[model samples]
Target: MIIHFYNILYAFYENKDIINKVNIGGIIVKNYIIIFAIEAGLTIIYALFSGLNLLNFLNGTFTVSMIGLCIGLFMMMYSDGAYSIMGHSFRKFNYMMAPKRIKETMDEDPDFNKKLRIRQEKYIWTNPILFVSLGLVIISLIAMYSMV
Candidate 1:
């Protein structure tokens, strides 16, 4: 799994689009470390603020864990093509396309599911922010269990 992950990331970095977006400092701080710091600070501060007492603070750990887990989970879901398909909303609003292309009598992309799967695999490996959230989730879960 780790090897496959590395291969996917290697291919991603080799891409022209991602290569343009990456820099040494931006990759380290802006993309990865800074996000973790932000998530940690937000969760910890919220826990402290809402749970001033010891027992309440322990209770807040659950909230913290849930938040981290939810963020990580949602990212995974989105990468697997959640909002990519406007679906019912597109039909109702007809805004994803004008009335012309929307009414075209053509079948959907036959390879859409295959492309979606490939995209999801790439995203799971290439997205450092998702890993940061997963890390935060693990930390929060540990804290919650250890405190109890």
Candidate 2:
């Protein structure tokens, strides 16, 4: 059973697209690291405002964050290859997972302009989202300090 499981996972790991994405840090690593860093920073900031002295807060946050980070990373790694866990190659999984409607639409439409427009629309909200997150972080920090 263990050998079979290893073989299945190995197949997914060896897939060209999966290997390329994993190696280039495109599919998950970079984005997941940024997300985890933001969450960990917020956790530390919240801990700091919990009334513990700096040293205690630092120590507590470090301990808690390390454990939480390990667990979080493990879960992310496990989920990154959903198909591998179910005994399917990543390439096959991705092909199967793609939306049929989107594929058909793209196939029927040869215009590159529509695709470019969709891509641009996706990026339009990035600035607003970042600003909102920054505002929320600042407000939380101020509120936490006010409590002290």
Candidate 3:
């Protein structure tokens, strides 16, 4: 019975259309907060393992800002990479999994997939807002460090 339930769950995720829709819905929900938590945990572990006084580290404005900068950059990198790989993978999966009519139309117009692919690929590299925000954070971190 347990094996049967697992198979049913696996089958649902294995369906490309369902998975793509789910991924689309998750774009907003799946974001930097999750990465920040993971990075924070790692940062805490590093601080502890390195024999740093946690209170002193946390009390330093520069140290706190630098940690935030690191987490933000790491999240940006992760989000960009995932977007790049998943966008391409989604297109391929769509081509393979689309219904008969859609697949026929897609085949009739070779450029259809290509055009959609270019748009999706553009997001991975052309996020000005993310870059500007990260830049501001880094600048603030540097300013704080200089003041210290």
Best by lDDT: 1
Those runs of model 1 whose alpha carbons end farther than 4 Å from true positions after fitting are: 1-29, 51-62, 82-126
- Model 2, position 53, has a per-residue lDDT of 69
Q: What are the per-residue Cα lDDT tens digits for candidate 1 across 31-90?
A: 565555666576578767887665455455445545655766777776766655544354
lDDT of each residue in 96-115, candidate 3, tens digit only: 88999988898898566543
lDDT of 2 by residue, 35-147 (tens): 54665576677667776565445444445445554555445445455434444344345546769986666557655222111111223223333433444445545554765
> How do all models score by TM-score?
0.42, 0.26, 0.30
The deviation in Å at residue 66 for candidate 2 is: 2.1
Better of 2 and 3 by TM-score: 3
Stretches off by above 4 angstroms in model 2 are 1-33, 80-148
Candidate 3 global TM-score: 0.30
Rate residue 128 of model 3 by lDDT: 32
Query: Which scores better on lDDT, 1 or 3?
Result: 1
Local distance difference test, each candidate = 0.55, 0.48, 0.51
